[model samples]
Target: MNFKNFGSQKYLLSEKMSGFSSLAHCFTTREGGFSTGKIQGLNLGFRVGDTPEDVTKNYRQVCDDMGFSFDNMVLSRQEHTDNIRIVTEEDKGKGLTKESDIFETDGLITNLKNVPLGIFYADCVPVLLYDREKQVIGAIHSGWRGTVMGISAKAVEIFKEKFGSEVKDIVCAIGPCIGPCCFEVQEDVAQHFDSEYVLKKENGRFNIDLWKANVDILASAGVPRENIDIAEECTKCKNQIYYSYRAHGKEHTGRMCAFIELKD
Candidate 1:
């Protein structure tokens, strides 16, 4: 992943996906926007107690910086489910200019040109997938629950079943989130994942490696290991740059946006 600053706005772009000229994608940071107070600066989530006007301005700022149309974006409701929404032209502007018709959807895939798929995240992992050959793109929000449910792998299946996308041809970029060093979980949460992905610390706490878990899940689902790029930056650790729900607490931290759109 590469950090880019456009004017005052900053975001992360996948180096793997950057080579594709027909696609535009970005993982937004908590920098550069019209928001203020606890949800200050680039808080893209409307439901996060940010002013609606400020949230809309944030979207516009990101769209202008990333060269994507805010009017052509489809935002995810993101209820931590493995549900994948196959986006089309009809879904454009939903959750932005209009009320979102999509619900309980944590993953979004689309082949439609110029229509951006947007997903919100703070500490939760943001997974971006693109099939260069099929001209299809997907953005997924995988919280621990969604990760255990294999939402990234489910996105691979949707690509194949819906767009005839081959796993080998798909490149995935796992964006910044809470890493193993900080994501200490309870026994109940740790039990859902395999032992290999969880580490028991000296303090009687278990740390879950969500990054490795999601990568393994995607690989097991048939995406080539070489084709995946993990950002490796821990959101909790780098709370100043990215939003970290764990570090800043739910009430204070703002939500970031992960976006992908196929070029027209």
Candidate 2:
């Protein structure tokens, strides 16, 4: 994944899927928006204690850069579960306009044109799915629990079941997260993973590679390995470029968005 700064908006694109002439998608960074202080730039998570007005303005700035409408954007509440919602026109602006309408899903999928779908993340992996065959797109938030539970794979499964999409035709991107070098976990993480990739540091902490976990989910969902791209940048390791909740540790932190829509 390469971080791209297009003036007021910074985003990440999958290198493997960069040249594919299909779905429009991006994994945003905390570099280009109107919020200040803890929620400094491009903070799209509306209910993270940031002012609603600031979040709205931030969306406006990001949408302006992405060429989408702010009021029409759709978002997920993200419960760290594998639940994925299929959004439609009726769901537009639910999360932003009606702050009370809490969305309880971790992923959103839609084929509707002009309906921008977004998910938020600080240290968690953001996964974007695009089906060139069905012209549908999906965005998912994969925290450690979500990754181990195969939430990314579930999102693709939904796309396949709902849109008749084949896994081979889907291109997936795993964006920047707390990389293995910095994502030290407890024994609970070891209990969750079924792989040999888990490493135990001399300090009695375990490290799990979420990027590999997500890519494995994609592969299990039938997405070809060649079609998947993982951002090599680690959020915790590169705190200056992106926010890291783990590094900040209760310090107010901003969040980035993973967004996509069917281009009209």
Candidate 3:
């Protein structure tokens, strides 16, 4: 991932997807917007106790900074489920500008140009995908539940079955989340992940490496290891730069997103 600062909106771009001239993708930070309080500065989620007006302005700031039409970006209601939604031009402005009919879906895939598909996060893993050959884009919100459900692999499956995309042509971008350093969990949570992805601390707590787990999932699903890029930044460890649900809980932290659009 390459760090970039455009005015006040600082973000990271996926190196694997950077060479594609038809699209724009970003893993945004918590700086640069009108939001305030617990969900302060560049907050993108309206449901996270942030005012709708401020959230709308924050969205505008990013859309403007990234040269995206605010109405063409589709933001969905994520419930940490493995549900994947196929987005079309009709779904434009659904969650952000218009009233959202989409609910409980944690994944989004689209082929339309100028339509930015986005997934929000604040520690939970955000996996954005692009198939340069097929011009397909996807965004996934893979929290522990979605990770356990294998959402990333499921997305790759959908890319093949629905879009006829070759796995080798697909590039996966794993954004910043809660790294294993501070993703300590109890025995019940640790038991769900594989032994390899979980680390048993001397204190009896377990740390889960979500990045590796998701990368392995994409790899196993047929995407080449070279096509996957991971942002090693941990939202929990670097809460000052990004939002961290683990660092502040649902009631306290703001939200960031992995957003991508197929340009015309």
For candidate 1, write residues 1-264 as lDDT tens digits.
889999878889889889788999999999888899997888998888899999989898998888898888899688889999999778988988778889999999999999999989998999999999999999999999999999899999989998899998999999999999899988999999999999998888899999999999899999999999989989999988988889988788888988999997
Residue pairs with backbone overlap in model 2:
none
Please state every model's RMSD to the true fold in angstroms: 0.9, 1.7, 1.0
Q: Which runs of model 1 end up more than 4 angstroms from their true locations?
A: none
TM-score sort, best first = 1, 3, 2
Off by over 4 Å in 2: 19-22, 99-102
**Candidate 3 lowest-lDDT run of ten:** 64-73
The lDDT for every candidate, in the order shown, is 0.91, 0.81, 0.90
- Selected candidate, larger TM-score, 1 vs 2: 1
- Of the candidates numbered 2 and 3, which has the greater TM-score value? 3
Q: Poorest 10 consecutive residues of model 2 by lDDT?
A: 94-103
